[model samples]
Target: MLPILDWGCAMYAAVDCLSETATVLLFDPNAMTDDGAAAWFVDAGSLAEWLETWLAGTGWYREDADEYEDVAEPTPWETAASRIAE
Candidate 1:
């Protein structure tokens, strides 16, 4: 899988995954506030629509993206690290 290195973009994708009932790990060197997360969630619908439009414009979907797969839950230390990184 292609690794996501952008913190803000990763956070957005993580939320998107959560909204769709999937799991994701969000980590950022720079901290994000609760308000920031809330604001993103507030605009998630519009953001998702725009993302889909942009991806479609770039023919990204034609690349045959795989379906979401279930992954093992993170360990306590991993969860703590993810939270700290965020």
Candidate 2:
């Protein structure tokens, strides 16, 4: 993952470099799961989409709430990271 933007509040915008389209993933470090692990959400398919939401006041950052809770996962990324390390 290549982080491209620092969208504060413990969130960051990164690009999945391993993906074919370099899909963007929004990382929310504080949004833990049942086991208390951080997860990533794909709210924006691209930089443009992410910017649109931010500008339009419809992003997860807005209202200080996770609006796309049902739109994401965890732990899968950890597996992928281990695989890549090998």
Candidate 3:
């Protein structure tokens, strides 16, 4: 009886482990994408480091938000132009 209970417990643990692994495997899009962008962007790195690297060489710093507040809202002309480009 004790041996049976141990086997049952081990089976239950193995099923739970397999369930979690399956969920992760199913949702991993990098396994499907050609360029593997997901793996590149989400590699072992700090969030701040990622953000800094992304914003580098671009003029779009968070500090510029206040400066552009007045012109932040898109004009109808700008929206129509963007839609046409898209």
TM-score of each: 0.21, 0.51, 0.21
* Local accuracy of candidate 3 as per-residue lDDT tens digits, 1-86: 01111113222101112222211111123333453322111111233432343356222224565565432321112122232234
Please give, for residues 1-86, the per-residue lDDT of candidate 1 as tens digits: 11232435443333334334323333432444553332222211334453454455432223343342422222222233343346
Clashes of each: 0, 0, 0
* Structure candidate 3, residue pairs in collision: none
**What lDDT is obtained when candidate 1 is compared to the true structure?**
0.33
Give stretches of model 2 more than 4 Å off: 34-38, 47-86
lDDT of 2 by residue, 1-86 (tens): 78888878877778877766566776776866654334666656666666666677765555645656642232234443343355
- Weakest 10 consecutive residues of candidate 2 by summed lDDT: 71-80
The candidate that achieves the highest TM-score relative to the unseen native structure: 2
Q: Tell me the deviation in Å of residue 18 in model 1.
A: 4.6
lDDT of each: 0.33, 0.61, 0.24
In Å, residue 71's CA in model 2 sits off its true spot by: 13
